[model samples]
Target chain A: MSIQISDPMLPELYKVTKIQENTHDTFTLEMVPKNKTKIFSFLPGQFNMIYLFGVGEVPISISGDPSSTDFLVHTIRAVGTVTDAMSKIKEGQTVGIRGPFGSHWPIEKAMGKDVLLIAGGIGLAPLRPVVYYILAHRSKYRKVVLLYGTRSPDDIIYEEEYQNWQENFDITVETTVDNTDSEWQGHVGIVSALISKKDFSPTNMVAIICGPEIMMHFSVQELVRREVTWNDIYISMERNMKCAIGFCGHCQYGAKFICKDGPVFCYSSIQETLKRREI
Target chain B: MKMLKTILENHPSFQELEREHLKFVIDNAENIEFKAEELLFKEGEKADKLYIIQSGKIAIELFTPSRGSITIQTLGLNEIVGWSLTPPYQRSFDARCVEDSQAISIDGKALRIRCEEDSKFGYELLKNFTYTVVQRLQRTRIQLLDIYKIRT
Candidate 1:
């Protein structure tokens, strides 16, 4: 179902169907529209402004498979007052959702080219939808390489999914942890370290990165070192988004409003702004 | 010797070294392989060799009272491991093979003597090792930040 934007600012009521704890601080919320028959449709990388009754709202990425129209999914970390409250919300509770906003990962543009997905920490939430899209239409793309990094082995989200993607699909999935105990046998290093593995060609590749700003910066540098062009590289930027539209200056980075102009942007367009110390 | 020289030439760490300097280092190096689960060196052991990984993975680990053995880092194909070239050299962590691995192990003592005999070769080796050290340090710093952890 396509998104029905009756009012950009007003949120529609949605009933929480399930909540799955991904880690100590991260959880996935599955919700469906309370009064509408149509499912909430959104492109990969777009976000929804999830609101609790008395508490405020926060922008969270749409993390579910786009083809699955049964419910909308969001993977969020309980990092602030609003998100902390949202974490305690029970299944069957009602919440407000306003969007499907911001730019999306260029899945269509990436057709016939190698797709590189690099995600760090909870940054993987925004890129999960893109992974689902690529898996559904696997034949449309060339080599698909996913390099994910987390704080530790326990912090890794979608652990079984990574194994499935690696074993079942014709994709290269390399997961690294910043630190790990002896029980963890996987690579232990920064996410950027995995780039040198060179499982996919840099030529004719579309790279999508979403992570802590510093992590993204270094990952971009490594990709560029491997000859991936700036135009072919995309990044999802996070900011304090109050309004899902350009009217609010809260999410502005340089002249671009992250909520409207991006969340997903070609790295070539904002490399300069990204380098700025404060914006 | 020719094969070892070729491997060193191809490795990014030693690729830019002067031909004679490369040859000098390779002279003190020999091909070695370790099976999966083999311990290459142990913590506090006399650090005698530096391994230039040709293929496969090796974990640099530290043993803690609580965790037993926690991996500090994993070095893979074309990477360098071990760097106790100074006096009173001792392995700071245990290096164990995570998979069947091949590398060129350079005798640290021989290489140190070679460095003293030839300052140019010493400078070259120092430069390359310094680069590796810096890179590892930067990666360690990033890991220390726990960037993936949710910060409220």
Candidate 2:
């Protein structure tokens, strides 16, 4: 979605329509614009700044299907102040939302090429919309593969959807956990291990990764080792974003304001900055 | 024997070995398979063999008092499964077949003798195994970080 800059800083009122508990610490919130006719639209990878009254706001990626005009969805882990408050919000309550900000996954660029998505933990939240978009336009891509890794079996998000995607769609979904007991009958290892399990034309693929910085670091190393170029790899980066626009510099990484220049960045563009310590 | 040799040649762990060294490995190797849910080796048992997985899955697990067998890693096609190649060599974790699986198992005793007799061959194999060990170590460290945990 384009930046809604007419009132970029102002938050539109949206009401919590439903709240689904996804895991012990994570939850998915579905909100509809309080104004009956207002439409909330976002492209995959864009994030909305969710404002919970009296508690403050946090930037959360839009996790629902982009085609659905009814409500905005965000899958959030209750990590800090605002999100902890957000976790307690019940259905029918009101919250403020601004934007659909930042650049998005380059779905058009991946038209004829294979799309590889690597997500770790809740990092899958931002990439879910991309999967939805791909399933909606299945023929545009070739050999779509998603490699997701989380802490354990219980930590996996969208577990039911994984089954649906595997059974009904043309895409390939491979999941692994960092560790698991015998009760879990799936792969147990880092997400990077799944990269070699599937064959994709590295030179003819677009890889998008969103996860812990270190996990992304190793995954990129593995992809590059497999001959995928940095130019074709994209990563969604998170920083402490205070303002959704470029004006507030709280989320600056080197010379770029993450709020404006990214959330999603081509690895080649930020490779140097990404390697630097404490930017 | 020829098919097994071809499989060894392609395996990442043995791909770098010289022709003679490859022959030595092939001579010491034998085809082995395990049915689903079969135990390959348990922790504290003699680490007498190394397997180059040809098909299916093997889970490297640790038996804990409270949690039962916890799988730390899973090995599949073209992956190496055991590497306890030092003195007092004993399996550090339980290796169990997650499915019907096949592998080329090398007799560790014979392999060790060949390595002791030929320093060059020994170095080559050790180097390859070291690379695999290092990669596993890196992955283990990443897992230990619990990088997925929510940061406050």
Candidate 3:
């Protein structure tokens, strides 16, 4: 056996068991830890760097819940070189993984308040872990709503789980597509259109959202219109990340490092950063 | 066809085309109508054709989990839409009609075939598409640069 250096922050190579396509360029990779007994834990928004030997590695948000250490999962979009390499790997192929890193969703604080979760396109992957965490501990919160939007109905991710969330009485879910097809029968418009129609008390609710930078900024404005405090809204961000440890400046968002300060952060905490497109 | 000639003749991108060439292409164009909130094309839909806005607006948007649908850009009259004619013939983003609109469109595949048959038309269309993509790319780069997002 070849001896490998051990890093507390890095999870050992795990074999990818499956890859599920979400959109034309996005996919979900399911991998079980090489040492399954060594539990890897993370907050809902935390991410990892899955190292594919020879082809290199890329930072990917963990889409799996912290509650279960059985298998680590990632929902990734093939945007560049490393991601393209990641998409090519198949079942039985071993890939290196590091970290359940970054600030997690504020689950403890969201308790007892109505939670509004909004996701756009592949942005749902990062929010998936938090949704599972909320549902797993259902009694801790009041009403819940998951409002999502994608390019089209076909671009919606997590089909089975989306249905399951819809079935639960405590949680409500709605989806919108930017463009509709012949078979599509749902609402067709910008995701922001749905906000005006939602009947939720912004005063007693915390909103969690992830997707593109522009989308989050606009969503914040909408929630503010509803009287939701900036502090009550949290948004996850995506940036080019080489080191999950934050030593590298690749994932910098203004003064905050997305890898260190958060992959998830309350709008109040990073309002300034969020405003700047550079972050 | 006459309406198309007038519209294409006025468009900023097509203004440089020789009048004869403009009229020739315009003669083959067709007008299409879209109802308010109707999808023009989805994210992954095959881009079999390209469109030129005659009247009204089209919104290009991207979905995010934290944010619902984020409107990226709104193209109004005289704008060209769709950019999948090259090697990677896939739609990159979603396009929808923000209002009931009228547009002139040409079958992209058919145009490509025509371009193959007639090199001059191919050169003209490619030049126009390149100009359109470059202009849009500049705007997108500025948006992604996050300069406006910064409060200070």
Candidate 4:
């Protein structure tokens, strides 16, 4: 069952090591190579093609810490057929993992600058690794702030880890829930509102945003108002990815491919493509 | 009500108020404290006062039929807790203390009257409240978008 990762097309078999419910509908999955001791590694913003037996594969971001070599982790919200089926699978099941693909977040370039991480809903799954990397090597960066927004209080992911990220890692984590629950006592507004309330200077600040396309679009606008240039802001784009190898036209956005050219890209690079309402 | 000039100057919204109008607000306002779980106001009540939180948190809530009480927002220090503008001024949501909290309560009636007497001050206050209203409106719009859902 231990398979090699040299062939980027054929997925190496991996067995689900752990599974946990992240929210009412989303789940976090951990997998390790079924036969091989070496599981493929990934960068913060990269993803893998998760294949469900007899079903299909979907491009899911690698949500685990890059520094930790133990197992590969992914957070999946059961929306479509494949993901819904994957969500129903129990631990100790076999699945296919075809990558650690795509360009990574600009973690290295962000060194010595203030880092602002903005996530919306399940979008946090992709950005969680960036936070982890920053926490692991906190000395490399300046102030790190995470502004996360969700639909309602119940939709938050990694609720238990937020406290530790704040207290131990010293990252500013501000969360907002649009709707209310008795247990939720936080800001009730868009993440942009929280950005206004913050004092992060746009100078020498790099912002990494991942969320709904619309939310990401607006977050960039707000940051621009705060003097963050489009060049310094990066966003993770999601599209219909089939090959993830750039050969397939399924993931094209203008000249770039969402799977190969990005999943992570600077705002300035794709501003034109992003503006097209229907595309 | 003796006021700290720094307090007024520190908040972005209050900072925009002319000094005299700022002083007028401080003079008309009274500091009050509420214990945890205490209700400051309720939905459908006449908008009598607006509270600017000095410290602690206030839960802006609504009574949901399915979920009972749902807190829509938590107002903290330097944040205003009540919105009362123009006619038919009525509280749309419940306000409760999340923790032992201190805030300054500005009488809505007195504020309206002051605004009427001083047209310039009235315009300034209205302008400030407009920002608040628009901000809340944008937030509401995002909430309606359910930006977090797996699919739109």
Best by lDDT: 2
lDDT of 3: 0.75
What DockQ does each candidate score versus the true complex, computed on alpha carbons?
A: 0.75, 0.78, 0.02, 0.55
Off by over 4 Å in 2: A1-5
DockQ of 2: 0.78
Candidate 3: segments with Cα more than 4 A from true spot:
A1-11, A277-279, B1-152
Ranking by lDDT: 2, 1, 4, 3
True contacts kept of 1: 0.81
Candidate 2 per-residue lDDT over residues B41-73, each given as its tens digit:
999999889888888899999888998888989
After superposition, the stretches of candidate 4 with alpha carbons farther than 4 Å from their true spots are A1-5, A35-39, B1-3, B17-19, B30-32, B64-67
Better of 1 and 3 by lDDT: 1
Which lDDT tens digits does candidate 4 get at residues B71-127?
A: 766777677877575777888899999889888787878888889999989999888
Candidate 2 lDDT, A92-120, residue by residue in tens: 99999998899999888998999999999
- Which one wins by TM-score: 1 or 3? 1
Model 2: which residue pairs collide? none
Clashing pairs in 4: A2-A35, A2-A36
lDDT for each of the candidates? 0.88, 0.89, 0.75, 0.85
- Which 10 successive residues of model 4 chain A have the least lDDT summed? A1-10
How would you encode candidate 3's per-residue C-alpha lDDT over A58-165 as one tens digit per residue? 778889776877788899877677888887878899998887677877788899989988887778888888899988999998888888877666677787777777
Q: Give the TM-score comparing model 3 with the true structure, all chains together.
A: 0.63
User: Where is the poorest 10-residue window by lDDT in model 3 chain A?
Assistant: A1-10
